[model samples]
Target: MYAVFKRELFSLLNSLMAYITIGIFLLAAGLLLWFFPDTSILDYGYAELTGFFSLAPFLFMFLIPAICMRSFAEERREGTYILLATRPLTSWQIIGAKYFACLVLVVFSLVPTLIYGYTISKLAMPAGNVDTGAIIGSYIGLLLLGAAFTAIGIFASSITKNQVIAFAVAVFLCFIMYNGFDAMAKMALLTGLQDLFMFLSVNEHYQSISRGVLDTRDAVYFLTLVFFFLLLTHFTIGGRKW
Candidate 1:
């Protein structure tokens, strides 16, 4: 797992995909947070990172899919996925290593955005008057959400050899997972089951954690989402010929 993780992390960097992915994320985020007039944090008149947390999930929805689209799909397209079976690594390890590699990139991409938090802190009237707890909680929530998305992306990649198809499927699935359940909860018929639907929703749990409560249920929900998809990826890969 470590070997695969290191190889993937560096290989993407060597190919400049890592730089491009991180750059795009930062650029889009920076524009909205700093440059764009309507979305600028400076105009918000408050020391808060709310705009970032709110906008990031949507950005990551597409960004992460693009990042993982080539994980297995590229190997499969080039007829290299078959060669992976000869390695001693278990299917789960392979899936996990690659998943973590992608997750690391997601985390790495967020590092540059820390500047937003710093800027917000300084912009506060009292200087450092921001809600430290809330910011920390939101960052944690984002990381968890990103992890789930990474798993879904890798699973989508595993199912198809075409990178475009993988990206589309991953984005679709991430959208549904993130918001479909909450949308369902609004129906009068599902009102009684609203609790269940909210529980299933990535957005619902994310909002809960965003409040700085650090609820275990929300964390568990994200973990469950990640594990479920990784399991599916394991099966999908195992089904392929050795």
Candidate 2:
């Protein structure tokens, strides 16, 4: 597993696509948080990063899919997946390595954003008037969210040989998981099931954690979601073996 993980991580780092994807995410985030009039922190007259936290998931919806689309798709497309599978590693080990590799790229994209928090802290009226707890919670929530998205993306990649299709499917699934439940709950037909729908929404749990409370329920929901998607990927590749 470690060998696979190392190889996968190095593959991502060596790929120009990975650099471009991370670059775009950071660029867009910078524009939204510091330049755009509507969402810019400069106009907010405060040290809060509410705009960043709110907009990040939307950016991630596309970024993560792009990163993971080629994980298995390219392997299958080039007929290299067979070679990979013939190795000593178990299915879970392979999937785990790829998932963590993609996740590390996600973290690489996010780590630079810590500068934003630092800048905000220094800009505050007093030296550091920002809500440290909230920021910490939001970062934690974002990491968990990224992990779940990585699992979904890996699952999407495993089922298809077409990278484009994998990307589209992953993005669609991420969007639906993130917001569709909330939208469904608002419909008249689902009115009685609003609570349940909201409970299932990734955004709901993310927002809950972003509030600095660190509820175990939200953590469990994300962990379970990650596991569920990874399990799906295992089943998918396992089925292909037969």
Candidate 3:
């Protein structure tokens, strides 16, 4: 498992697509949060990094799947997945290794954003006036959210040999998990089911953690979602492709 993890992680780091994906994610996020004329921090007239937290979830909805689309899909595309299945690893371990590899890259993509936090802290109306707790909590929410999406992406990749289909499926599932429930909750026809829909949404749990409360339920929600999808990936890999 560790060897598979290392191999997959290094493969991602050594690929051009990985850098392109990271660069695009950071560039779009940075511009939207602090540089774009309309949405920039300058326009917000505030010293908080809240705009970033507001924007990153939407950005991650696409960025993460782009990185993960090729994981199992590309392996199967190039006929390497068969060899991978022959290795001395359980389906769960193999899927876990791939999941962790993508997760490491996700963390790599997020670590640089800490600079935004530092800058916001010092650039506030009063030096260091930022709510450090909320910022930390938001960061935790973002990482957990990313991990959940990675699990979803790997599962999508496992179900198909087409990277494009994997990307589309991952994005659609991520979107539905992240916001579709909230949308459903707002529907007039589903008004009575609002609470249930919201509870099923990853965004609901993410918002709870971002509020700086660190609820155990929110943490469990994220872990449970990740586990469910990874388990699905293991089964998908062991079964026939869709």
Candidate 4:
């Protein structure tokens, strides 16, 4: 498993995929939080990063797909899927390795954002009385959402051999998971299912965690979403052989 994981990770770094993904993420962060003066998190009266956290999910909608697009799709497109399938590794091992590699890529991009936190601290009136609680909570929420998006992207990639198609499908699915449910909830047609839709929506849990409140329900919801997509990816790969 470690060998497969390292191989996937090295492949990403060698191809500069990691660098490109990180660059895009940083660019989005800078544009949304730095260039926009009106709604930037820094402009808020409180030390909380409400604006930044709220904005990060939408940016991640595209960023996570870029990171996971080529994970399985590139292998399949190059006819390496057969080679991998014939190896001693199980399907789970291959999927797990790629999943883990994508996760590391997400974390790699996120680490640099800590600087924003540090800068916000110093800029705060009391030399670091910033709401570290909320900041930490928001970061946790980001990680969970990233994980869910990565899983969805991986599943989408597994269904197609073309990287571009995989990317497009992944982005569409990511957008749905991130915001589609909430939008559907607002529609008059689904008024009766409003509670169910809102509960199933990713934003509800994301918002709760971002407020520095780590509710167990939110954690469970994220875990369930991640597992559901992962299970779907596994089945998708398995079905291809039959």
Q: How high a TM-score does candidate 4 get? A: 0.94
For model 3, give the 10-residue run with minimal summed lDDT: 233-242
Error of 1 at 165 (Å): 0.9
lDDT digits (tens) for residues 142-166 of candidate 1: 9999999999999999999999999
- Return the lDDT, model 2, position 48: 91
Q: What is the lDDT of candidate 1?
A: 0.89
The TM-score between candidate 1 and the true structure equals 0.96
Single out the weakest 10-residue window by summed lDDT for candidate 1. 10-19
Per-residue lDDT tens digits for candidate 2, residues 3-65, read 989998999999999999999999999999999999999998989989999999999999999
Predicted candidate 3 versus true structure: per-residue lDDT over 180-220, tens digit per residue: 99888888375569888989999899989998889999999
Ranking 2 against 3 by lDDT, winner: 2
lDDT score, candidate 2, position 136: 96
- The numbered model that scores best in lDDT is 2
Candidate 1 off by > 4 Å: none
Candidate 4: give the clashing pairs: none
Kindly report the root-mean-square deviation of model 4 from the true structure over all alpha carbons: 1.6
Model 4 C-alpha lDDT per residue in residues 1-242, reported as the tens digit of each score: 78889998988888776687779888878778867878776566666567778888888888888888898889878888898788899888988999989988888888988888898888788879888899999999999999999999899899998888888999998888778888888884766788778888898899999989999999999989988998999999988862
Error of 2 at 42 (Å): 0.5
Error of 3 at 97 (Å): 0.4
Give the whole-model CA lDDT for all candidates, comma-separated.
0.89, 0.95, 0.90, 0.86
RMSD of each: 1.3, 1.1, 1.5, 1.6
